[model samples]
Target: MEISCHKIASGKASGPALVSKEPISFLGTVDPETGEVVDPKHQLFGKNVGGKVLIFPGGKGSTVGSYVIYQLKKRGVAPAAMINIRSEPIVAVGAIISEIPLVDGVSAELLDLEDGTLITVDADSRRVRTEEG
Candidate 1:
């Protein structure tokens, strides 16, 4: 399926989709060390977001989410890209500062996208295409 949305950064990315249907609490959800989600109740709990396309509804908690993202990037555990159902300032700021590809306001077809699917996100054109592995 094809979903059209606004992309924050244009680039090619292929990896698993770490889907999070609920809002992620950036303050506690991410572990800076392993670049994995540490929040036990999070759908992506214990899952490594590094090199994955991290998808979610949006971010919650403190505004320092951007800092956390920067730290993750510095640690070399940042996601290849980010996809959100909607854009939140916290997440947007992080994406910009981290220079990670970000797309948002996409359809639920994004949720149907499996973890291991090879997907490309074009932030410049606001497009998301899924390819079979």
Candidate 2:
């Protein structure tokens, strides 16, 4: 499937998708050292975002979350790309500074995509494409 979106960062990446229905707060929800989703309350708890295309509705919580995203990058454990239904400053800034490929303005139906589906994100082109699982 091909999905058009607004680019939030400039880059291209391909990986398995880690779809999340809820918003993410990078500050407390993810471990910068390991890139694991640490929030037990989150649907992605125990899963690692490293190398995956992290997908979610948007971001929430402290603005410090942006730095956390950068920390993940420094530790070499950040998402290959990200796709959001909406783009908020925190997440958008994080992705930008972290140099992670990010795009938003996607349809909510994207949330229905199965986890681990292979997907490619071309932020420069403002496009996301998925292969049949």
Candidate 3:
């Protein structure tokens, strides 16, 4: 399946998708050094987001969440890319500063995707493509 989205950051990434139902706040919800989801309330808590295409509804919480994303990147623990249903300033700024690909306004295919589906986030073209439709 190929889904179109608005480009929030420009880059390209491909990997297994790590889908999250809840919105994320990088500062407290994710461990910057480990890239693990740490928010107990989140279904994906305890899972590592590193090396995967992190998919979530959107970002919530502090503006510092951007730096946390950058921190994750600097620590080599950030997601390969990020996709969101709505790209808010917090996450969009984070992805941009951290050089993580980000695409937003994509929720349809995301809802149907399996946990570990291999997907490509082509932010340069504002598209997310899956092997299966």
For each candidate in turn, the TM-score is: 0.91, 0.98, 0.94
Error of 1 at 19 (Å): 1.1
Per-residue C-alpha lDDT of model 2 across residues 1-133, encoded as one tens digit per residue:
8989999999999999999999999999999999999999999999999999999999999999999999999999999999999989999999999999999999999999999899999999999999867
Q: Judged by lDDT relative to the true structure, which candidate is superior, 1 or 3?
A: 3
Clashing pairs in 1: 16-115
Where does the lowest 10-residue lDDT sum fall in candidate 3?
A: 106-115
Checking candidate 3 for backbone clashes, the offending pairs are none
CA lDDT, every model vs. true structure: 0.82, 0.96, 0.89
- Candidate 2 residue spans exceeding 4 A from truth: none
Better of 2 and 3 by lDDT: 2
Instruction: Tell me how far the alpha carbon of residue 133 in candidate 1 is from the true structure, in angstroms, after superposition.
Output: 3.0
Task: List candidate 1 segments past 4 Å from native.
Answer: none
Q: Per-residue lDDT tens digits of candidate 3, residues 1-133?
A: 7889899999999888888878888888999889998889888889999988998899999999999999999999899999998889999999999999999888655955787888899998978898742
Question: Candidate 3: where are CA atoms >4 Å away?
Answer: none
How many clashing pairs per prediction, in order?
1, 0, 0
Per-residue lDDT over 1-133 for candidate 1, one digit per residue giving the tens place of the 0 to 100 score: 5668887656656666777788876778998777988989888888898998888888888998888988888899999888988878898888888888988889866776667777777787778877766
Winner on lDDT between 1 and 2 is 2
